[model samples]
Target chain A: MKEMFLIIIFIVASLLGYRVIKEVPSLLHTPLMSGTNAISGVTILGSLVSTAYAVSSGSKFLGFIAVVLATVNLVGGFVVTDRMLKMFKS
Target chain B: MIGTYEIVSIVLSILVLVGIKLMSSPKTAVQGNRIGAMAMLAAVIVVLAYNGIIDVPLLWFAIFVGGVTGYIMAMRVKMIQMPQMVALLNGLGGGASALVALVEIFERYKQMTLFGRLTGQLALAVGAVTFSGSLIAAAKLDRRISQRPIILKNHGLISNAVLLIIILLIITASVANISGIGFIAIITAFLALAYGVLFAIRVGGADMPITISLLNSFSGLAGAICGFTIEDPLLVAVGAIVGASGLILTQIMCGAMNRSLVDILSGSQLNSGINKKET
Candidate 1:
C-alpha cells in the first residue's frame, strides 16, 4: 500500500514537473539544469536517515560520505545556478 | 492513514514545485533558486526532527564541510566552466545515492522485503552508472580527456553485454542470502561503473549537452529509486520532479541539435555520414 502511494506521487510529480519545466525559456536552460541538479540533492534526506540508523561502523561511514556528497551537490548546484541567473540580470 | 509527517512532506514538495515554476523567467530565477534552497533547508530540518537525529554532531559536521566546499567551488568556477561544474555535481549526487543504497543493502538486507531489496539494488545500479557517467562527461567537457568519441571496437556489443550482466546481478543480489548479497552488490557497482564509462566515452563533444542532461535525469532516478528503498515520500516526489525536469531538458537539447535521444544513446549519430557535417 505504501509503495503504491509513493508510485502515484512519483507519477504526479513527474507530470507536473514536465509541464512546468516546459515553460522555461531556452535562454535559461543552463540555470534551469543547475537548479534542478541541486534539487536532486534531495538524497541528503535519505543519507541522514540511513546514516543515523546505520548499525555497522562501515555503513555509518558510507552514509556520512553520502551526506557530504549530497550536500555539496545541493549547495554548489544552487549557488552556481544563482550566479548564472545573476549574469542575466546584469 | 496519512500522518503529520506526510502532510508536512506534501506541503514541502508543493513549495519545491512552486520554486521550479518560478524559474521559467530570468527576472524571477534568482528568487526561485533561493526558494528552492529554503525548501531544501526546511526539508532537512523536518527530516532531522522527525527521525530524531537533530542532535547528531557528525551529520552536522558533514553538512558544514560539504556546504563550505560547494560554496567555494561555485564561487570560483568561471562561466565557461558551468557545464563541467554541473556535470561534476551531478556525479557527486549520483555517487551519494549509490553509497546510500549500498549501505542500506548491507544494513537491512535480511530484514528488507522483496520489494525493498529490488528497489535497493536498482538504485545502486542506476546511481553507480550515473556517478561514473557524469564524471566522464565532466572530464570530456573540461577537456581533461579527449573530446572526440572514443569508439572502441564493437563498443555497442561490449556495452550491451555489461548492461545485461548488471541486470542479472541486480536480480541475483535481490534474492541472494545476506552472506552473499554484499559481495554481489559490490560486483554490481563495479560493473555499472564500467558501463557508465563505456556509455559516456563514445559520445563526441557535439553530443555532450544531451549526454549531460540524460545523466542528470539518471541522478534523479537514482535518488527516486533510493527513496523507494528507504520509503521516504518527500525524497520520492522531489527526485521524480528533478527527473522529469532533466528529461524535459534532454528533449529540448535533442530537438535543438536535430538529433534523437536514441541516436545519441546508441552512438549511431556519431558515425552517420549525413550528420557528420553538423558536428
Candidate 2:
C-alpha cells in the first residue's frame, strides 16, 4: 500500500539524515538549524494551491495568509542561514 | 501508466532529497541550500503551471510582499538572534500548513472519506501545536519569556488530564463524523493550541534546541499529513525529508545535553537551572 511505502521511506530517510547530520561540527549547529528551517518552507506550495483554488472567500483569505507566512519563512530562513554560513567560511 | 507530470514531480523530489543530504556537509552546505531552494521553486512552478487556477497575479503579488518582508528581517537580525529567528520562521511554516489544511477541509467537508478526514485532523492538531510551541520557544530564546522551566503545581497530572481530554474529543468528533468547524472541533483546536504553549513553557533554555528540533519534526509531520489528504506526493516526500532531518537534529541535540526525550518532556529537570546558578 502507499501508506506502507511512505512509512518505509520515512524510516530510511530518518536513518540517513541522522548519519548526515552527525558529521556537522558543533560550531555550525545554528546554521544547520537555519538551513533546515528554509527547507521546511515547503508549505508554500500548499498555501499557493489553496489560495488559487479556494471555494469560498474565507478559504481564499486563509490561503492568502498562509502563502505570505510560508514565503516569509522560506526567504528569511535561507538568508539567515547564508549569513551564518558566511561567518564560518571566512 | 505514469504521466509526464508525475515523472517530473518525482525527479524534482529526488533532487530535493539529494540537496538535503548534501547540505549536511559543511563544504557543500551553501550549494545544497541553493539546490533545495531551487527544487522548491520548481515544484511550486510546476504545480501552478499544471493546475488551471485563476487569479495567478494576486498570488504572485502576495509572494512578492512576503519575500520583501522576509529579506528585510533576515538582513536586519543579528547573528546572536539567529536561533530565535529560525524558531519564528519554523512557527510560521507550521501555521501556514495548518491554515491551508483547515481551508481544504472546510471547503470539501462533505466529500472527504474517513482517511481524508483523519489526515485533516492530524494535520490540524499537529500544525497548531507546532505553531504555538515554536512561537513559545522563540519567545524564550528572545528573552521575552523566562528561560527557566515554568512548572505548575501537579503539572504532570494537569497536563495529562488536558491531553486525555483532547484525545477524547478528537475521537468523539471523528467517530461521530462531526464537521471540522463544529463546536467539538473548535474546542479541540483551542485545547490543542493551549497545550502547545504549556508544553514549550515548561522546557528550560538549556533544552530549547532539542525542543525546537522536536517541534520542527512535528511541523514536518503535519505537512506530510496535509499532503496525504490532498494526494500530493511531492508534499509528502518533502515533508518526510524535513521530518526525518528534524528528528535526527533533535536526537543529536538531546545527546549534546545528555538527556532523554522523556526526561526533557517530563520536566524532571525543571530546577537544573537553579542548580547551575548556585554552582
Candidate 3:
C-alpha cells in the first residue's frame, strides 16, 4: 500500500512536471527557471525537517547526507546567482 | 497537497498571466495559466499518495511558507531582482531534493542487500551531481561567476574520463561487494561534484536558463531514483514532478534561444555575449 503511494507520487509528479515544463514558450525560459528556482528553494526547509525527523539508524545516516547536499546546493547556487545579478549592476 | 516547486508553478502562472495580460498577450498568459494549474493538480496527487491524506502539519507549513514568501517577494522583491531570487530558490529546491536522496543513500548503505547497494550508489551519484551541477548553473545565471563561458580547452575529455572511471569503480565494488567499497564510492561522490562544477563553468550566461532547467530535472530524477531505492512513495512522486518539470523547462528554454540541447551540452556555443543580443 505504501509502495503504491510512492509509485503514484512517482508517476503523477513526473507527469505534472512534464506538462508544466512543456507548456512554456522558449522566450520565457529564464523567468520560468528563475521562478522555479525560488520554488525549489522552499523544498530545502521541507527536506531539512524530514531529515531532522528521521529516526531510524539508516534514515539518520541518509538524513545527514541530505542536509549536507542541500546546504551546498542552496549556498552555492545563491552565491552564484548573486554574482550573476551583479553583472547587470555594472 | 502542495510543495515549493508547485507553488512556483502556480505563482509563475499568475505572474505570466497578470504580467502578460497587463503587458503582453492574454493568449500566452492563458497557456501559461493552464500549465500552472496542471502543476498544482500534480502536486496534490503526490501529496495525497505520500501521506494518504495531507498531514495537517505539512499542509500548514507548506501553505504558510508559500504565502509568506509569495507576499514578501511580490510586495518587496523588485521585478528586476525577481529573476535572481527565482534562481536562488530553484537551486535550493534542487539541493534539497538531492539531499533527500543522500539521506536514503546513507540510511541504506549499512544494511544494503546486494541490489540495494547498486540502487544506492546510483542515487548518490545522481544526487551529488545534481547538487553540484545545479549550484554551478545557478551561479552562472545569477552572474556571480563570469557570464562568459568558463570552459577549459580540454574540459570535455577530462570530465568524461573521470565520470567513466567513477562508474568503473562503483561497478567493481558493488559487484564484488568489497569491504572498502563504501570508502571508494565516497571518492566518486566528490569526483561527481567536481565534474558538475567544471561542466557548468564552461556554459555561458545565455545558456543558463536552459542549463538551470536541465540541472533542475537532474535533481528531480535523483530524488525519484532515491525514492525508488528506499521504497519511499512520497519522495518518488515529488521527485518525478521536479524531474519532469525540469526537462520541460529545458526544452522551452532551448526553443526560445533557438538552440538544440546538443549545442547547449557542448558548452562551446553558449556564451554570455549572446544574452545582450535580445530576449
Candidate 4:
C-alpha cells in the first residue's frame, strides 16, 4: 500500500509537471532552462539528506551515490547556465 | 565501501576543472552543453564501476536501457516540450524525497523513541507536503489545470496561524509519545499542498522559474528531515547539501527576477493583504 501511494504520487506529479512546463513558449526555453537548472540542482540536497540518513553500512553506499549525482547536477548545471546566459550578453 | 553520489561529485569536479582549462580557448555553446552532460554521465559511470556490485552483463544492460530511452525521447519529443520535461523530472525528485520519508516513518514506528517520535512526525509531514505541493506547483506551471488565481484572502496569515497551532500541539504531545496524531500531520500535508498550489497559481507566469526553484529547495529540506529521522550521517549530509544549494539557487533566482521572498510567499496579488498595510 505504501509503495502504491508513492507510485501514485510520482505519476500525478509527473503528469501535472509535464502540463505546466509545456505552457512555456519555445523562444524562452534557453532562459527557462538555465533558470530551472538551478531548480533541478536541488537534487544535491536531497542526495545529501538521503546519504546522511542511511542507517546501514550498505545504505551508506547508496547514499553516497545519490549525493554524487546531485552534486554533479548542481555544479554542472550552474556553469552551463552561466555560459548560456553569456551568449545573450554579446 | 562505494556509492553513487560520491562518484558523481568527483566526476563533476573533474569536469569543472577540464571545462575551466578549455574556457578561454573558445568553443560552441552547444559543445559546452554536451560536455556538461557528459560530465554528469562520467560521474554516474564511476560510481557504478566503483561499487563493483553489478555484473558485467548487467552493467551493459543498464547502459543500454538508459541510452535507448534517452535516444527515443530525443528523437520523438518536440523542442517545446523541454520545460515540461524539466517539471516532470523535478517533480520526481520532490516525490522521491517524500517517499523516503515515508519509509523512515515506518522505521520509527518499530522503535518509537522520544526524539524519534518527534523527528519522525516532522519528517513525515514535510515529506507529505512536498509530495503534494510539488505536484500542484508543476500542475499550475504546466497549465494542466485552469491558470486563473484561486484566491483566498488572508491565506498566508491563516495558514501561518493554523500551522503554528498544530506545531505547538504536536510539540506538547510529542513528549507523551503521541502516535495517533500522525493522521493530523497527514492532513496538514494536504493543506500545505493545496496552499502551495494556490500560492503558485497566483504568481504571474514570469515568476515561475523562482517558484519552481523554491519548491525544489523545499524538497531538499524534506529529504534532510528524512535523513535525520533515519539516523544516517551520509544521508543528512547529502540532504543538507541539497537543502543549502537549493536555498542558494532560490536566492539567486529571486535576485535575478527582482522579487522578495516575502512578496512571493504572503503577498500574492490575489491573496489580498495578509500582511498589515503600511498606511
* CA RMSD of all predictions: 2.0, 3.2, 8.0, 10.7
lDDT of 1 by residue, B1-279 (tens): 489988998899888888887886788889989999999999999999999999999899999989999999999999999999999999999999999999999999999988899999999999999999999999999999998888899999999999999998888777765578888999999999999999999888778878988999899999989999999998998898889878988888776666777777666655582364452
At residue A75, candidate 2 shows an lDDT of 89
Candidate 3 on B1-279: residue-level lDDT in tens?
355644543453343223222211223433333343344344444443444444535334444554454444435545555454454455445545555545544444566665556656666677667667767765666678887777786888998987898698668756775666546667867887787787778777777767767877776676666666665444455556556666776776666666777666667564533453333
lDDT of 4 at B47: 39
lDDT of 4 by residue, B153-210 (tens): 8766766665675566546545765466545555655655554555555554445656
Ranking according to lDDT, highest score first: 1, 2, 3, 4
- What is the lDDT of every predicted structure here? 0.90, 0.77, 0.55, 0.47
Q: Second chain only: TM-score per model? A: 0.95, 0.91, 0.68, 0.65
> How would you class the docking of model 2?
medium
Give the runs in model 3 whose Cα sits over 4 Å from its true position.
A1-28, A34-90, B1-78, B270-279
Off by over 4 Å in 4: A1-90, B1-77, B110-112, B165-173, B179-185, B267-279
lDDT of 1 by residue, A24-87 (tens): 5778777888888999999999999999999999999999999999999999999999999989
> Given candidate 2, what's the lDDT at residue B68?
98
DockQ of each: 0.82, 0.60, 0.26, 0.07
Model 1 chain A weakest lDDT span, ten residues long: A17-26
Q: Candidate 2 chain B — worst ten consecutive residues by lDDT sum?
A: B270-279
lDDT of 3 by residue, A1-90 (tens): 544555566676666666543355443445445434432332433354445555675655555444443433333333333333343345
Q: Give the TM-score (vs. native) of candidate 3.
A: 0.65
